[model samples]
Target: MNDEKISVDNRDYVGALASGLEVLSAFDVQHKKMTLSEVAQITGMDRAKARRLLLTLHALGYIAKDGREFRLTPKVLRLGYAFNASNDHLDVVQHYLQSVTSELGESCSLSILDNDEIIYLVRSSAAHRLMSINITPGTRLPAAYTSMGRVLLAQLSAAEQKDWLARAQLLEHTDNSIVDKNRFVNMLKDVKQQGFCVVDQELELGLRSIAVPVFDYQGKLLGAANISTNSLRVSMQSLIDKYLPALQDAAKSITAHAK
Candidate 1:
C-alpha cells in the first residue's frame, strides 16, 4: 500500500510559507516577546532570516514591536479563533473540564493526540498551581509520559501502537518515568484493560494524574480527559482510588449526556 502523502500545493514544498509558520511557532508562551536574536535562537535560523520574518509579520500586523522586542498581536488570536470555531464541541468540552476543576479542585484538561504528541486543547486549572510552568490550552507533552496521552494511545490499534513504540524514543523524563519499551507496552495494555490510568509522579516530581478516554454519543473516540494534582497534597492511593473514579464518572457523564 502506498503511504506517501500527495502534495496539493503548487508552490515548492519547502518555501517561505513554511519558514514563516515555523517562526510563529517558535514564539511560545515562554518566549512570546522576543528580539530578532531570540527568535533566531528559538527557530534555529540566522539573525537575518529571523529579522526578515519578524519584520514581515510586524508589517502584516500579526506581530507588534516594543523597542527591540516583537510580540504577537491580536491578529494571532484569529488563527486560534478559526480552530476554536471549527471544532463544534470544543466549548462544550471546555465547560465540562472547568466543572471538573470546580468539583475536584484540581487541574483538568482535554487533549487529543497530534502527530504522536498529546496537545491540550481545553484546560481548567484550579486556583492553585501544580508545576513550575502553568498549565494552559495548547500545552503539549510527550504522549508516552502523560496519563491523558497513555489512555488516548491505548485507543490505537495493536499494530499502530507497535509502530509508535518502535519509532518512539522513550526518554526517561524522571526517575519514575517508564523508560523500558516492554514495560511501556505492558502499561498500555493495562490501560486498555482497565479503561483508565493513574500516573503518580511519573512525568514530573510531585505531580500525579488520572485519566479516562472520552467518547461521543455514537461511541467514537473524542480524546482523553485528565485531572492532575500535586502528589504531596493528594496521595497516590487517592489518585488511583478516588481521582480515577471521579474522572471516569465525569467522562461517562459527558459522553452519555453532556450534549
Candidate 2:
C-alpha cells in the first residue's frame, strides 16, 4: 500500500496515532512476523521510533513478542470485528455474494476503492482457485488492473477521474495488461456508460473477471461486485451473457436490502 499521507496539514491530525497505525499495518501476509529492524525498515521509521511504538502496542495487547520477533495477537481481530459490527449492510452483501457464487460456481467478491487500490470487504469463493494468492477480505489489488477496480473508478466524477489518471502508475502486470493512458481513459469511459467492466487475463495469466457497481438504498455506491474465474473455464462472451446478469441482479438486491 502507498504510504502517502492524506491530510497531514489538518490541525486535528495526530501524528503519533497515525504512525502507530502505520506500524501495525506493516505486518501483513508477507511479513507476519518481524524483528524490530524489519518493522523499522518496512515502515521507514528509525529503529528507536519503531521500538517505542512496538513496545506500546505490545503493552496494549495488540502485539506479542516471541524471542526477538513481534507478531500480531488474536486481539487484533477486534478491530476487524468492530468494522463488521458497525456496518449492518455487510451481512446482506455476503449473503448475496454467496448466492452468486453458488449460482455460477465462481468466486465472487465485493471491494471498494482505497486510494489507488481496491480493498476487498467480502468474498465468496468457489471450489477452484483463480489466483496463486489466497484472496480474502482485506486483500488489496491495483485499481487500474482489476474489473472491480475499473467499475469503482468509472463511478468517479470526471475531475476526480482525471486526477486519479494523472497520479496512477500504469504498469503491465501481464502480457494483456493495458499500459497506454489514452486507451485506458477511453476504456473507463466505456465502463462508465456500460455500467460494468470485464478484465481478461490482465492481472494474472489465466484469470478473467467481470464486475458491476453496487449501491445502497440511497444510491450511495457501496462497492463493486465481481465474479472471477479461470479464463479457460469461462469465456468472455459467457461472462457478459450469463455472469453479468447474475452480478447485476445481486447488486440490485444489495441496493434494495442494504441501508
Candidate 3:
C-alpha cells in the first residue's frame, strides 16, 4: 500500500515517528554521515527538531555518533532484515532472477514502485556493469525513466497515474529521455497493452532494459522483473527476440512458486 496516501490529520498518524524515520532515510549513500544542521537541511526540519530525533535514534542504538557527525548503526539493518524475514517469496524471486542472469549473461532485478521511484528489491548481477553506479537492493531510481519502473507504473489505476504524473519531475536524464508528459502517458498505455516495456537509453546513455510485471498465483501484483544490459552490446530487437522470452519465463516461474 502507498503510505503517502495516509492523511497526517488521522489519529493513528504519529508525526514524530514519521519525522524520525524520514531523518533516518535522509542518510543515504551520498550522505552517509551528517551533522545536525545537515540532517535538518536534508529533511527540511529545524535544527532543534533534527537534533532531538538524531539523539533519540542514537539513544535507541539505531544511530551512532562519532564526534559531531551521526551515522546509521548496524541496528538500523534490523528494519530491512525484518522485511526480508517476513517475505518468504524473496528467496524464490532471487533464485529465478539468478537463473535468468546466468542464462542471459545480463543483470536481472526485481523492483517495486514506491512513491515516484522504483526501489530494487532483489538483484542478480552478471560480469558486466550496465550503469556507472552499482545497483544493489534498496537502490532507487525514477519510475518514469526505467523499464521496470514503467512496467510497475503502467499497472497503477488511471487516477493514480494522473496523480503520479502531476507530482513527478520529468527531467531529461539523456537525449532519449521522454520529458513530455503526454508522450510519456501514451508510452505507458502501449506498455500496459503489450504487457511489458522497453526503455532505451532513457535513464542513462548505453543502458537499455526490458521488463514485465510479476504477479502471484492469486494474481496479486508483486513487482517488475527486468534484464538490463549495455546498449552497445545488446540491440533492441535482441532484447525482444531473446531476453524477453527468458524474462517472461522467469516471471512465470516466480508467480507459480510464490504461493
Each candidate's clash count? 0, 0, 0
Candidate 1 lDDT over residue span 185-238, tens digit each: 999999999999888777789988889999877898889999998888988777
lDDT of each residue in 1-259, candidate 2, tens digit only: 5866568978868999999999998898789999999999999999999999999999999999999999999999999999999999999999999999999999999999998999999999999888988999988889999999999999999898999999999999999999998999999999999999999999999999999999999988999999999988888889999999999999999999999
Give candidate 1's TM-score. Answer: 0.84
Error of 3 at 36 (Å): 1.4
Superposed on all Cα atoms, model 3 deviates from the true structure by an RMSD in Å of 1.7
| Candidate 2 overall lDDT versus native | 0.95
Query: What tens digits encode model 3's per-residue C-alpha lDDT throughout 1-259?
Result: 6656668999978999999999989988789999998999999999999999999999999999999999999998899999999989999999999999989899999999999889999999999877888899999899999999999999999998999999999999999999999999999999999999999999999999999999999999999999999988998899999999999999999999997
Of the pair 1 and 2, which is ahead by TM-score?
2
TM-scores of the models, in the given order?
0.84, 0.94, 0.97
Which portions of model 3 show Cα errors greater than 4 Å? Answer: 1-5
Candidates in order: C-alpha RMSD to true structure: 3.4, 3.2, 1.7
The 10-residue segment of model 1 with minimum total lDDT is 5-14
Better of 1 and 3 by lDDT: 3
**Quick one: best lDDT, which candidate?**
2
Model 2, residue 62: displacement in angstroms? 0.8
Per-model CA lDDT versus the true structure: 0.85, 0.95, 0.94
